[model samples]
Structures are given as C-alpha cells and as structure tokens.
Target: MATTTDKVLNRKIVEKARKMKSYAYASDDPEISDFSHPSVINIADTVQVGISTGGSSPAMARKIKIKTESFLKKNISSEDIYQIKLQKFARIEAKQVLSTQLDRKKFLYGVMNDKRVKGLLKEGKYKMAQGRVKKMLRKLT
Candidate 1:
C-alpha cells in the first residue's frame, strides 16, 4: 500500500491552527438564557457592553454587568437615538452650506453644546430637539 503526501500539509499556518485553543459553553434549558463569565449588556440592538474579571471572579463580573446594564437602560432611551438621527440628517444638509467637513463638524459641535438643546435632550423631548436643530440649520443657510 502507498500513501500520497500533499505539499500544503507542511505549512506553518496549518500547524498553528491545529494548536490553537477552542472554547464552548452550553445551557441546559432552552427557555433560560446563559451569560458568558464576562457578562455583556446589549443596548438598542446597536451598542454592547462587556464585563471581564481578568481571570478573577465570574460572579463579580456578572454583578457589575447587571448594575451597569440597569443604569444604562434607565438613562438611555429611544428619544436620545432619535435626536442623534435628526442631527445626522442635519449634518448632510449642513455639508452643502458649510463647504468643508471641518466646518460642518465645528457647526455641529456648537449646536450640541447649546444650553437649550442640551436641556431638551436631557428631558427626552426629541421633537423639540429636532426643531432646535432645524432653527440652527436655518441660521447657517
């Protein structure tokens, strides 16, 4: 019997891959969810937070994650995202008037720092914030 040797079998990359570590975790019940030792917080389907113990206690990581997630969920709302989206659109419109990216960014920075706009956003009044941005944009035009 004769065996054939492949030229690609001598590659260093293949050897390194074979020696790499593998990890897996599973939960017994499908209804119940499990979090990794380094727990994570998922926000608005866009942002995520990860807590790691740095090879310490998993329990501590989980506790910290719960507190942090709860606080963020309480503070951050859809209205905040809506205000951001409104600003993004305003930026596109501002580009035509501002002439340069740097000018647009500077204008946006000033708008964001405006006291009235800040108060409206803090109060979760996205509609008012949008109006404020429109008024500011009108000034630029």
Candidate 2:
C-alpha cells in the first residue's frame, strides 16, 4: 500500500533502529536494549571514586571556590562560568594597568582610532601595551 518513497524511508528508519539497538547493548546480551539505567549507576560510582581520591589540586580548589562564591553572589549558572572568569581577569588586568597611569587619554584614543592598537587590544594583548605605556609614562613623569 506504500509508495516507492515511503518504502525507501521506512527501510532507512528500520536500518537506523537496528544499528541503534546493536550499539546500545553488548553482543552477548540479547535482552538489554537500553544502557541508560546502568550508565547512571556507573556515573555515580565514578563520581564517588573521584571525590574520595582527592583528585583536585589546590589551585583548582581555590578557583572552584571562587567561582562558586561568585556564582552564588551573581546567580550565574555553570554554563556562564568561562565568560565570568575571562571578564574577571580582564577587569583585574585593566585596573592594574590603569593604576600605573599609562596615558589613559592616549591609550583610549589609540584603542578607538588606531587599527593596530585596537586589533592588539581585541586580541587581549595587554602586555604589548605595557612596555609602550611604560616608556610613554616615563617621558611624561
């Protein structure tokens, strides 16, 4: 009763289902079709072992604590953690550079109008500005 296109599509779906079934269970297990139930248990066991082994470093622990505290304070989820880390680092670095009085007007103007400096800043090359700024600041001071 099916058309040629319908038959072809049905055949493709059957083949995909067969492949999925085969992949979901070991060759020796004929009764098991889904591994999700066992996979969850395995995941719990792995997490328990990892926690018991003290697998994290001090630096990693500190970073995690700081991230957790910041997330609690700001109501951020884990998905946004990397962006938060980058923003925090950038803010600290910018504050340090600004504290040094490295020609704020020139730097801002250059960043706004100069293609090369803007490109470098966009690429997060603050160190490149450090030496140049130091020299210019020395001249001004």
- TM-score for each prediction? 0.49, 0.20
What is the C-alpha local distance difference test score of each model? 0.65, 0.40
Candidate 2, residues 1-141, lDDT tens digits: the string is: 111345455445444667766434222222332321111111212221111113224345445555555445455433233333333444444454566545554544443354543454556665664444344435544
lDDT of 1: 0.65
> RMSD in angstroms, all models?
11.1, 17.5
Model 1, 1-141: lDDT tens per residue?
Answer: 011144233233333434563222222211211223457798876568789765356677888998899899998776566556667866877886788888788878877678888788778877788788778878877
Alpha-carbon runs more than 4 Å astray in model 1? 1-39, 45-47, 52-63, 74-83, 122-124
Task: Say which candidate scores most in lDDT.
Answer: 1
